[model samples]
Target: MTDRQITTTLTSPEDTCALAARLGPLLRAGDVILLTGGIGAGKTHFARCLIRSVLLEDEDIPSPTFTLVQVYDTRQGELWHSDLYRLSGPDDCVELGLTDAFETAICLVEWPDKLQDLTPETALWLGFDAGPQDDARNLTLTWHTPRWDTVLKGLVA
Candidate 1:
C-alpha cells in the first residue's frame, strides 16, 4: 500500500464537525481511525460529529474517557468509539474487544498512543494540534493504504 498524508485547518468547532460529517459516509465496517493528540485537541468532538452524521436517530454521544468505549448502530453498520487514555497497556485493547471490532466495525480510537503494538497497519491516523487561534485546530490525516487516497480526494481542497 502507498503511504499518504494531509493537513487541514479547522477555524472553529463547526469546521471540525463539518469535516467529520463529510468523512462519515465514506467509512466501511472494517475501517479503523486512530485519533491521537493531547487533551482538548478535538478528538472526541470529531468522533461525535462523525457518529451523529451516520446514526439513524438522535443519540447522546459522550466522551468515552470513563466508559472507555461506546458502541453505536449507524445506518451503515456498527460503530465503535473508544478512548484508550485510561488503558494501562496495549493488551487492554483485547479486553475491550477492540481487536475484533477493528475488523468488524468502524472504529474510532482516541489517545491511540496507548495502543502501541496493537495499532492496525491499515488504520487511518488523524492527529489534532493547537492552531494559531485558540478556537482553531490543525488536523493531520495519514494512512498507509491506497483506499484513503481516493476517499480523501477533494475532501480538503
Candidate 2:
C-alpha cells in the first residue's frame, strides 16, 4: 500500500494524551508507531498516556532513555516503548531486536528518525512539532500503508 498522511495541531500534554487515548481504541496487538520529536515535545508523555489507556495494571510508564526499552504487559497486548535518541543508525535497531518487536507486539518508538534505514513500509509515522506556545504540541500522522488510512480517519472523527 502507498503512504497516506494527516497532520493535527495539539495543545497541552492533556491534548496530546487525549490523542493517544483516542488512538488506543484503534490499536491492535501488532501495530508499530514511530514517533519523532525534539526534546520536551511530549513524546514520552504521549507514550505514557497511550500505555495508561491500554495497560490493565496500574503502574507508571517511565521514559526508556537510559534503559533504551521498557516493556509493559497490557490488556490489549504487550507494549514495547523504545527510545532511540541515543542510537546512531539503523544497525542499532537491528542489534536491539526492534525488528522482532515490530513483528511481535505493539511497538511505540521515539526518535525513530534514527532508524531511517529500517523504518518499515508497514509502520505508521507520527511526528510531534513545537507549538506556538509553551505546553502546546503539533502531531503529524503519516501512514505508510492503507492499513492505517481508516485508523487516521477515526482519529480525526
Candidate 3:
C-alpha cells in the first residue's frame, strides 16, 4: 500500500462518468473498488459508466440495492457490482458470494463500510461528498496498492 491519494471535483454527472470511463480500462480481476457516498450521491451512476466502459457498450446497469449483487460477463472478465447497504454484517457478504467474487472478479462495491473485516486491504477507496455547488460532487480516491500507481498516473494524464 502507498500513501497516494487523488482528489477531484465533478461539476456534473458527466464528469463522474468521464472519470469512470478513464478508470474502467485499468481495472482487472481481483481488484476491488470501494465506493462511499450518501444516498443520491451518484455512486450508481459512476458504476454504470464504469461497467459500460469495460463492456465497450451501452448496457442497462440496474442498481444492486435490492439484489445485493449484479454480475456481468465481459471480454476482460467477470465484473461484480455490489451494494451492501442491506447487509447486516460482514458475514452476510459471504452468503452473497461477495467473498468469492472479491478473489475472482472486478468488484465495484457500494456502501463498502458494511464489509468491515471482509474488506480487502488492497482495495481502492473512493469517497464521494457533496460539493459547494448544486449537482457537484467531490471525489477523493485513495490508492492502497502499488498496482494502482500506473493506473492513477494514466488517469491524471
Which candidate leads in TM-score? 1
- Scored by lDDT, model 1 comes in at 0.93
Question: Comparing candidate 1 with candidate 2, which one achieves the higher lDDT?
Answer: 1
Q: Encode model 1's per-residue lDDT on 51-107: one tens digit a residue.
A: 999998998999999999999999779999999999998899899999899989999
Q: What order do you get sorting by TM-score, best first?
A: 1, 3, 2
Candidate 3 lDDT over 1-157, as tens digits, reads 4568988899899888999988898899999999999999889999999999888455789999999999998666999999999889998999899989999999999999889999998898998999878889999988777878877885853
lDDT (10s digit) by residue, model 2, range 30-114: 6999888888888889899988999887897789999999998887778899999998888998998888888888999999887
Give the runs in model 2 whose Cα sits over 4 Å from its true position: none
lDDT of each: 0.93, 0.85, 0.89
Q: Which residue pairs clash within candidate 1?
A: none
Q: Which ten residues in a row have the lowest lDDT in candidate 3?
A: 148-157
* TM-scores for the candidates: 0.97, 0.92, 0.94
Decreasing lDDT order of the candidates? 1, 3, 2
Q: Candidate 1, which ten residues in sequence have the lowest lDDT sum? A: 1-10
Clashes of 2: 0
Could you give me the TM-score of model 2 versus the true structure?
0.92
